[model samples]
Target: MSSPHPRLSARQPRYMIVAQALMHDIETGRHGVGSLLPTEAELGQQFNVSRHTVREAIRRLTDLGLVSAQAGVGTRVRAQRPVNHYALTAEGLSDLFRYAHEVALRIDSQEEIVADGALAAFLECPPGQKWLRLQGERFVRNEGESIGLAEIHVAASYRAALEDTNRPDAAIYALIERRFGVEVREVRQEISALALTAAQAKRLGVAPGSPGLRLVRKYYSSSGELFEVASNIHPADRFSYASTLRLRPTGESEN
Candidate 1:
């Protein structure tokens, strides 16, 4: 005979368990979007966990962009669907790459054009340099929402690599490596707040003038040659990014 409840693993964090349960409640319509969630005391009692554990769980929810907590007011749901939360630990600087796996990126179009004027300046490309551009949107699994708009521009030399594959969303860089037999040595990332343009807003299912996050990344080879540049725009409410930083002792050189 099977036991009604299995023994819990000691390695599991209580806060994570509580968080998952709360997220389930949110996803299943137990707690609708824009609605206030139960108080910490209530949630603690319901989950049979400590208030501290509940607090941590709420923190996780906050980090995921599912809910927002106010000082006097209770936590309120911010999104209708489960937020795609990415946990970037200290081991990797390529946090956005980790995010790529969690969301579905469907390529909408691809084109080759010579970069000039402001576009060349923005891409850091020399005038008249040719680039292959892939435009797409990112969707969360099981959620029918376009959370982000992405534009990837590859240097002309690697354009054939992108053409060799049908599923650009899955792993474009890996394909490039296989095609060109080259490896990326460094990834430079920059983030900024942006107001959505009308076109971008329409594609991302957000209102014009809405606040969004702009992520710009540059991929380079061992010889310091730029291979690709990518820019992604995410609605402020639908996406959240978090990273864990480790403090090192003084006088320790970075590897």
Candidate 2:
């Protein structure tokens, strides 16, 4: 008989396997939005694991926002949306672009605009200065449903760099880096709850007041000057952000 696959690592448990199986069921249409999962006791017996183990597995899925539980009504499946595991760090900087290109998403628009107050203040530029604006909508290639939208603005000095390649699918940073030898060395980000503006909703084709993700970013060059400001809107069903924090001793220097 073939040897059974070795048990999962002692660190994270087989929660990943359980999570995967559940995801497959959801993906293949066996279970769908609002579908309820078997009870904890039933799931433990089904997976041949203890109730505690089952609870951990369920918690893993919950953290990803794929499942919800009611006190007595069992866990129900949430809308099956893209589970984008991303880091708000330099290493993961290319994820948004990757999502657009790899998914064969269509870009909606790209242009240059003069910044008004909020945009001017955010980019630390004076009002009416020319700023390169890249506005685009991305949707699943075959599905044809709008997945998200990105509004990116950068210094107009990079205008020539974007001469003819400003498509909905263009990578703004790539063009700047290639032409002006400017690399986006670091990105600082802050996330907050933002209600969609009427125009924002119309551009994205979503109802006004629909939940969305507000990703505000400042991109810095090697010299540490902030040169780009962007606000990306992701529908509540389209994304989830993840991060980890480590605590240090109180008296230790953060050097």
Tell me, by TM-score, which candidate is best.
Answer: 1
For residues 107-213, what per-residue lDDT tens digits would candidate 2 score against the true structure? 35667788889968888878898887777765555565665677778788877875655353445666677778888887788777777778878876556987888
lDDT per residue (tens digit) for residues 1-255 in model 1: 111123334467988777777777777777898899989889888878899998998998887878889889899998765565423333574555666666666788889989999989877879999999898877775566677888988888888787755345455666688888878888888889999999988876656998988878888888888888888888777666666668999999998
Q: Against the hidden true structure, what lDDT does model 2 obtain? A: 0.68
What residue runs in model 1 are displaced by over 4 Å at the alpha carbon? 1-66, 69-81, 93-104, 139-145, 164-166, 206-208, 243-255
TM for candidate 1 is: 0.68
Please provide TM-scores, in order, for all candidate models, with all chains considered together: 0.68, 0.64
List the global CA lDDT of all models: 0.77, 0.68
Error of 2 at 156 (Å): 2.7
Indicate the TM-score of model 2: 0.64
Clash count per candidate: 0, 0
- What lDDT does candidate 2 reach at residue 205? 58
